[model samples]
Target chain A: MGEAPLSWPDGNDRVPYWIYTDQGNYERELEKIFYGPVWNYVGLECEIPNPGDFKRTQIGDQSIIVVRDAEGGVNALVNRCAHRGVKICEQDKGSFSEIMCPYHQWTYDLKGNLQGVPFHRGVKGNGGMPADFSMADNGLDVLKVHVRNGGIFATMSDKTPPFETYMGNRILGYYDRELDGRSLSLLGHSRQRIGANWKLMLENIKDTHHASLLHVFFVTFGLFRVDNDSRVEMDDTGLHTALSSIRGKQELNDGTAQMRSFDSNLALNDPSLLDVVREFDGDQTVVMQTLWPNVILQQQSNTLATRQIVPKGPNSFELHWTFFGYEDDDEEMTARRLRQANLMGPAGLVSMDDGQILERTQEGILAHPNEQGVVELGGRGTDDADHMVTEVALRAFYKGYRNVMGL
Target chain B: MTITPELRSEIADLANAYALAIDDGELDRWPRFFASDCLYKIIAKENFDSGLPLGLLMCDSQGMLQDRMEAFSKLNVFGPRSWRHMLGAVYTTGSEKEISARTNFVIFETLAGKDTHILCAGEYRDIIIREHGALKFRERLCVYDTTMIPNSIVRPI
Candidate 1:
């Protein structure tokens, strides 16, 4: 059978609505984009610090288990029994001696190697005559793991380049700045299921202009406005991006005066939420690094987190947010991070609007599947920008999407 | 001080009034339930059990509580919706200054034109103290069993 037809609107500016609504297109994305040669961000190495510690997570639509082996090495294994195809690992996170299937009693080691079978020599040799069942050949599907500093990324295809190469030199510089060799402590997590395409949230982070326009807290407080010193960057493939900005004062300036959302009278009743303890070696108060295919490393004020995108289907996805800080951070800094976190997550003062907008965005698009949304804020180009007023990153993302999906 | 019937009744009234203020969209009155300096956190039961210090909403002061309600009412953008909070039995114990209380909560949200559904199911763990003849929450920890949020908890649950 021939491939189902997928149409791409002319130029890099017009994004077709069908890309988000078509089930067939979504399945193609699962194959060509997620499970393809691209590197997918899984979790952090600090999460499973001890041997036998494991966490269940998703990449695309597949259930994956990231576990720490006895040798302190991390493994990303497909959470399916090799013999019976049972979905194992009920707990979201736990410590285990070995991975086991409760149904058939098929067992695997922490490294996902098949270690035991319920009846390898079935029924006291009555039915185990032709025993060519090889345990070595029946291990859980192991993903190629890349451990960088404390970040964990895995790939399904062997064609994936080295982690650094995949991130590119420019994006890697931005990544290392935040994930800088320091030991990290798991602060906590906020998991929410958003009724929008996974890519929409990625677009939200890469959207340099929306911070001030959509989030009143950002515009009124001058945390991320168009007037601030900000820039947008992209890698060679136009897949990876880093958006950074230096927070400005709350005073209404020429750039913010035009925003309808900005209200000068608004102020944080408790100013502690905006307390910025400059621990990182940079002046930028916020740096959102969006690694293609899965995650966004966020450094907003003192709060820090990694937002992982797990696509549920065509029009929905689960966002697993792991908030973290430096391991050696003082109690005050930790407190500051937690307090500042009120600005994000599901009920976050700023990010709460993002979920609503994305859901509405998809709803509106679903109403007219054949139509297209314009990504022409900056222009009809896909170049990095020194200003936030452009949608070049969004355009770049679609350009990469078009190439990967072969649309 | 001991667990008396009068004090238990007063605590129950406070809990009812608190939920009413939020469910009824009388958000301005939400902050009045707490002391001037307080700790109000809506935490996940999983995180609370693991002793992880994180919550969906963490307000450590009266000002922060006001900040949240103000954001919800004025700045934040969300779907037009209303919620009904059905609280379970309110249990209370007393001390010299602080009264410890716990109550189970189940909230059903009704978005405009949508079917009403359970938003979250949780238990409230509160430490109440009297300030100027009125009982107020000094530390209110809302640990929810439903960790996977439905879209977003727009109206504070």
Candidate 2:
């Protein structure tokens, strides 16, 4: 068998299918994107609020442990045991005074320092270390941790810029608007394994054109119509984007007629599902923001949630959704958010179509590996667009992706 | 009051009917198995046990259930699949006015040319009441053991 020729198109407008299907590219992404100068979302600081509370998570394929120290500071450490490289913590979340390896009982403090070695000095001075093994030298690999508005982020690279500098003022403004000084309470969690490449999932989140076309529930129920006032904004680097739309009275226009889901007679028996309580004080009913690598902050109506995309392999990824509400929310406000939660999830009414669509998309591309996907709907560049029905966000993603992978 | 075999059989039949209705793609008939003001939710057992109120599908009223059925039938796009619901031993207590029953269930899925796979396994904690001369569910909580849902769950389990 001969080796297949690999080629990348000239610009961000064309994406080769092999990127999603090639094993070599996936491995390269793990190093260049995941392990490079990028701040990865680990978990929420509120998740480990109390002292000694910890949660196990991942950055790329490397397992990580996020815990609260005795001084109420958050720390992130590699979950591998320094001796034999065994996983130190196996449970998802717990409260522990110290992280003790169940295999050989190599104890580590919450800061991931090697505290004790069970058989050190050979238990009877027979077969342990030769008197020169320092416990301080065997501490677990720890990553730099940063927390902003209760959101925890970590990076393996010391060269990565500060969190604020990396996000820029525009993206930081959006984050502050959603979760600036407000305290968060975890309402629940839902995990879904999407049968597509991880990038495809992120692209779907950045896509605003598909909302009115693929998701009939969104347009039919008057949540977001094609004629609604909307825009797609991106940061100066084009690595981050937010597709925002405000609810307006539905009216028939050229754009509405072009959509396949523009049915005026469709009605919902339970209209309360579409009720917006105006919690954010902004008129935007939907705001889907995606950070470069894998973090998404969504404000759909009054429902607030953050999604972290973790790649399982080249062909699949796991989406971890953490739904939240304000700490000062009354019973009625919380109930409203909970009720609106039905609009987004693995089985969400307006968002469930994405899972199947992405799967089928990967399947379609796999059938023709030599072909390229045309992302020229908005234009041939990664600049910000003023209309929602544009593919500029996808172009922006490819731009950032190529910049990182050097493809 | 002591539970009678007649009431037990009636409740079992109601459970079976609900399962068959969903499995047979008669989703329009799903709302008929519940009362007007009812709660039907499919939640992870971990969340349910931890007092987390999140659910895969949370319908607070029969109207919401009807809306879900309509959306699944008319709006959602998914592959061709069929569900097979298997019910375990059902235990019922309480009087005829308001009966409580607990039973286990395993739902299997057969996609278009694929082998049948277990979709979800859970226990149903139901509150049944007599309404309009028939037993109906006032609240049905489907607590699943599987936390990570495969792809998407478009159908009721």
Candidate 3:
């Protein structure tokens, strides 16, 4: 309590405002949570199918280049060049046989192995690199990468557990359900920069309380609601959460009468927007999972996507959406995936309200850095719940966060 | 079939009227600019160039457009704001049935108490046809170059 500026109260229900606003805490989060022994989502294997295909992305605030090598294997490398610390890959994505820092032309193979340095041999040995300078000793920083199904994740620390063990058993089931060993093809992407604490975005999906209340499209269309059959499950470490809900028809009863976002009169003129074709083996129409620290896997109807959260600062994050569908999907199925995509993303009918809400939440938190948010909706205990009326997953999330961050 | 000067003038008027409808805050009339069976999509240029079929907003029929505008006006929660849509010339090149037109556009948004900023910068690749006597958009593809949308896009661009 001496050097710490935050005065946290007991229990996971009390989330202090300082965690969202404090610069010191933010730095610690970057170190312990992001760069620490945790697997961070980089990109998908399908996004880089061909050898030499590469995509420049982020892990926390650090730039990462996820590339497929000539050997048809995926690799994750720090974007910074080993020579002059220059960002090697400037473009978002492209097919590159080799990487060269635009600043000095320091070259590297697709595996990020230092291939050549222009001045290393230096003009017929006049000003060359030292005799002991080895290319193997000076390669772009590599991260331990795990590519399973079609998804790709990387970890900076060696102490991080394997991908399967890290995700735990419960969360892995949900993760595999989406990927399912199917060949995935890229649909598209929509990016947004939100001015708010990054964790709020995670909490936003983890919290089912706002789904039926804040989104009119969700409530009016019966896509998700508290009354619907829903389940909230977390990983053993409580670092990941999956919220699944079966879509029910909207009815004007005691439940709908109490809500402000729902309107019986409001209906889609084109009902084809909700023309959901049952594909998965479950009755649940929505499965939104938060893969701690980075990505959110969204499976709302036929719209399948990964919302990658790249934290820019203490109070801001860049959300990168990678929309995809199975390669074997017929033209009609592809169209369905494309059509259903309107329900999420930046201009999503049901999701467009989220970025603004998070920014507003950040604004309020910045105003009152001493206050804390109440997470006692479902009680203090973090347990699996079969109902939507619970903040248990959030409490579990913070518990995992606090354990890793040592808050 | 022929490209007449009168037809060009009519197309220009249609484009201006479309911009004025939203800038004037008459979101109710937003869907009227399109034909009954239309395609109005707000897509990123990256995806467009890459042949990706996704969009920030994708509406196939006029009914879908109405649904989108309805969601924006009635239920979607966002700060009160206004836009100033600045458009360049609507270039027209066509066939005997419909005219294919493209125009560069930029929209600046200002919240009630905030300063004005560039909300989006993109080109509208459209297909124009006559619904009754007036020209209506059969397909309005808003391919925006702004990769990162500055917060939320509450209203359609």
Candidate 4:
């Protein structure tokens, strides 16, 4: 089939629209991108800290079990039985010596090697004539795995770029500053489904300009003001970008529009929720890194998480927002973090309204598939393209996507 | 075990009134169901087991709960829809003034001419208290049995 043309505003040819909706494009992504030479974020090191620890995870629709073996070495193996294609690791995550499939009781070690198959040797030595059937030949597929600063990554393809090279200097710097050897803690998780294309989901997040206007909760609470000066730095690769901004503090007596009501008295009611205010430099900025294709690295409003987008069907996608904090946080701090988590989850004050809007936006797309969205928010010129609030970042995403898809 | 007739009647009335207020979209009246200092959390059973603090809806203090109601009615945008909540079997335990009651409920929502289907099936773990002359909820944890919510749980379940 022929590709659909994409027309940019200023006569610059955009990538084909089929990249967003076509089935053929999805198949190519599965092969060349997801299963290709890209490093995918699996989970945090804190998730499986001890020996016999494990977590069932997916790498591009392929089920792979990530386990820290008895020797404390992390390993990832495809969750499939070699015998009849049944899943070898059935459970989501738990400690186990070996996985025993219920279908035929075929057992496999944590390394995903065939340990034993019940009745394989033949009962009473009367039957079973396959002498050459070796268990060694039938084992789970293992992928090369690595860890960087407590972050776990896996790649299906052997020729993947080094983890450091793939992440680039910009991304590594952010991780170095933010993570900073702190013991990672598992705060909680929130999942929501938005009825828009997966790319749009990533775009909506990394595009920092929407916070002031799109997210009313931010405006109401005085967490971030719209007039803040921020910059969107497009990575050298164009796939990732950094959004940095310091929202000035709202003067209590200025009578400026703040979050909730004008009465500062109500803000003091829940001291833990909206207790402190800080200068623009001290303002915690959200650095969003779109790790091409599926994973989105998000740091915003004291909330750190990696939003894993899994497209279930054409109409919708599932977003698993796993929140994390430093493990050494005190009980009070943890509670405060949990209370503050309401800023971006499904029920988050800022995010609760987003899902509904996204669903409706996609629904509206049905009316005009041929028509395209205008991405001239930052500027028209490509040279001065580093602005916080523009759809130019989306254009950068499409650049990386097209390169990956060979469009 | 002698089921107290008075306790059962009061709990039943509270459950019915709670569902009616929410489904009818009575924003201000819903807060009357809870105490001034209350904990209202509606979380999935999956998240609870995982030790995650996240909730489909987490509200501490009637003010936060009231804040959500305000957002729903005034700030947050949603489609034109109506919900019919079917509250079933109220099991009350503890003293008359301050008791713990659990009730099973199924909330049905309809939008854009679509009929109401079961959105979520959960139990309301309520900590009831008598403040002055009225019965108010000190804590209401809407614990949902189903982990995978239907489509998008936009409205409160």
As for lDDT, the candidate ahead, 2 or 4, is 2
Highest lDDT against the true fold, candidate = 3
Error of 1 at A114 (Å): 1.0
Highest DockQ scorer: 3
Name model 3 segments beyond 4 Å from true.
A1-4
lDDT of 1 by residue, B80-150 (tens): 99899999979887683888999999999888888997878999999999999999999999999886787
Candidate 2 C-alpha lDDT tens digits along A196-302: 99999888877778888898888766577657788788876677888888876556678778877778787778888877777676778888889878789989888
Quality class of the docking in candidate 4, CAPRI style: acceptable
| TM-score of structure candidate 2 | 0.97
Compose the digit string of candidate 1's lDDT tens values, residues A170-204. 99998999999999998888888888988898999
Tens digits of per-residue lDDT, candidate 2, B1-157, equal 6668988998999999999999999988988999888998888776787687888788898779989999888889888999999999898877878898999999998888878978888899999998888889999999998766788888766
In the order shown, the candidates' DockQ scores are 0.80, 0.78, 0.87, 0.45
lDDT by residue (A12-80, candidate 4, tens digit) is 234333445555656667788778998877877777888778888777678888988887788888888
- For model 4, state the Cα shift of residue A288 in Å: 2.8
Query: Residue A330 in model 2: shift from native, Å?
Result: 0.9
Per-model C-alpha lDDT, please? 0.88, 0.85, 0.89, 0.69
Q: What fraction of correct interface contacts does each candidate retain?
A: 0.75, 0.69, 0.87, 0.26
Error of 1 at A313 (Å): 1.0
Please count the clashing residue pairs in each candidate, in the order shown: 0, 0, 0, 3
i-RMSD values for every candidate model = 0.9, 1.0, 0.7, 2.5
